[model samples]
Target chain A: MTPISFPDPDFIARQTAKMLLEVKAVHFRSDEPYKLTSGLVSPVYIDCRRLISYPRLRAALMDFATATILRQVGFESLDAVAGGETAGIPFAAWIAERMGLPMQYVRKKPKGFGRDAQIEGVLSEGDRVLLVEDLTTDGGSKVKFAEALRTAGANVTDAIVIFFYDIFPDTREALAKHDLRLHYLATWRDVLAAAREGNHFPPETLAAVEEFLNDPLAWSGANGGVDRISV
Target chain B: MFDQLLECLNEQGAGVRAYDACARMARARVSEEPDNAAAYLLLAYVAQRFVESYDDQPLSVEAASEEFQQFTDIVKMLDKAEADASADARIAALNVVAAKLNTAPKTGD
Candidate 1:
């Protein structure tokens, strides 16, 4: 399969969002807002994990991810790809293969028995590893994964995810404090735009979604979830 | 183990190879660190790949679920495996990876 050679970030973002909608991986449930790990009740929830079943689409998105990485992070800057635990593993394998780099996975924590390693594959000292995941909400896992990799001697300076919530203002700055540069194909904004352009949902539903995106914490607080995030 | 799996992958299908790669990587991990349950999990995943021939699609959803069911059954074996634990701490982990030098997916909530 040929890479799209996509240079336009906007096009990639919209296209990725469109594909997500096509697969029905993007779900809206404002009334029954789902509680997230960070304690925010979200009207929107995406399942990038489901993309693995659709090989062609997954490959295309991976290509977009590869191109984005090469363009933004530089082609030769990275030496390895590290996925964060379960969901991140598959995407990491694909991107590592695409970039011709070794792939490793970091567990949320050590296994606590046997070898008890947090890292599952061979990782070397000073390997410039790129942390990957299916999506990022507040970029909490990215920091944790990067720390594990860096602690194991991998020089992790960047991270990539298929989707980024990008709703919170502190997300980027928080990552920046830890020296992590986030790269992502799409965000809630792109998905909202796609939903709007395609009329995928009713105006009322879309408006509610927009309200949540506008101020997710406030929305959560008004809903049945916490207003602030701890992790 | 990887060589064997790659051969199966090349001869039988990409699905096997792809799953096998995950198995191999996990096997490498289990061998280095002995986690019995996870080792059983690795076996369950690898054995699941072979439950259905890569090229041959299940004729119906029922048939496909049968294959997936077999995988779950294999995973269930882990409980018994833990009960019958032997003195060798590394054996199960080693076997999982070992079966592979001859010779991997999941997601959700």
Candidate 2:
């Protein structure tokens, strides 16, 4: 297996979006908008976790991830790789293999007891850790995972995700306050561009999406969704 | 020294010997270049050798835990190493051994 070889960033984003679409990872519902756990109503949803079930697609994406991280973060910059539990674990495992690095998975909450309960495997003090996750909505969960790694004696200065919502402006700021750098393959805008180029949705639906992206709060309020994000 | 190391590894068990040899080589490689994070991983590979062959031995669960801990520490530092494709391959092979070691029970009980 080659150390690092796959899609470039642009190509990765395009193909990743395509893969998501191909696998029906993308969901669209205009009439009955689905309400997120956070109480935000959305016309679309994406499930990245399902990517693991497809071996060939998962393999290609992981190759892209390994190549991207090596090129951008330096092959040796990370001391260890941590995957946010559940969804991120498999991706982390494949990428860890590609990079030939030790792998650990972080829990959403502490397991049973003890400080290390939130962590699995071994991590050393001041280890330059890289956090891996499937997707980021508002970059909220990434901070929580980074904190867990830090508390466990890891130096989590960077994170990688397959997708980023990138709709909220403060997502980067929230990450910055905790000294976390976010790297991702694709974002909402990328998906939007792809949707336009591919004509996946009708013009009206595309226009609605554009309106939402331009000003989510205003569009949400107009569409009987939450006027302001709470959190 | 090479012969001595080999003999020491064998008497201790091939698994242990492989672990020690890999660790030794990794350390030596890293000393030649401090930026070499791959050495740390090589150490894990060495540990993995013991893990792979652990099933054949009669080690206590406690003893196995200690050995597993040592191996895990190597994986923990794998990413920080300087890039060396050959070393990375070697480390990956060791990880395969390590994973097998993780599942292999001490007494098959």
Clashes of each: 10, 3
The residue-by-residue lDDT of candidate 1 on B1-109, one tens digit each, is 2233333322322232234443554465556645554553556355445432431121222333343354444444443455567645345634645454234232110
| Candidate 2 residue A195 C-alpha distance from true site, Å | 2.2
Mark the regions of model 1 whose C-alpha exceeds 4 Å error after superposition: A1-4, A112-116, B1-109
> What's the distance in Å from true for residue B104, model 1?
31
Model 1: colliding residue pairs: A115-B33, B1-B100, B1-B101, B1-B102, B1-B103, B4-B102, B5-B103, B19-B104, B20-B104, B100-B103
Highest lDDT model number: 1
Count backbone overlaps in model 2. 3
Using alpha carbons, what is the TM-score of model 1?
0.67
lDDT of 2 by residue, A13-118 (tens): 9988888877877766555554443334466677887898899998888888887888788878988889997678888888887887888999976887867779
The alpha-carbon lDDT assigned to residue A187 of candidate 2 equals 81
Q: lDDT, candidate 2, residue A150?
A: 90
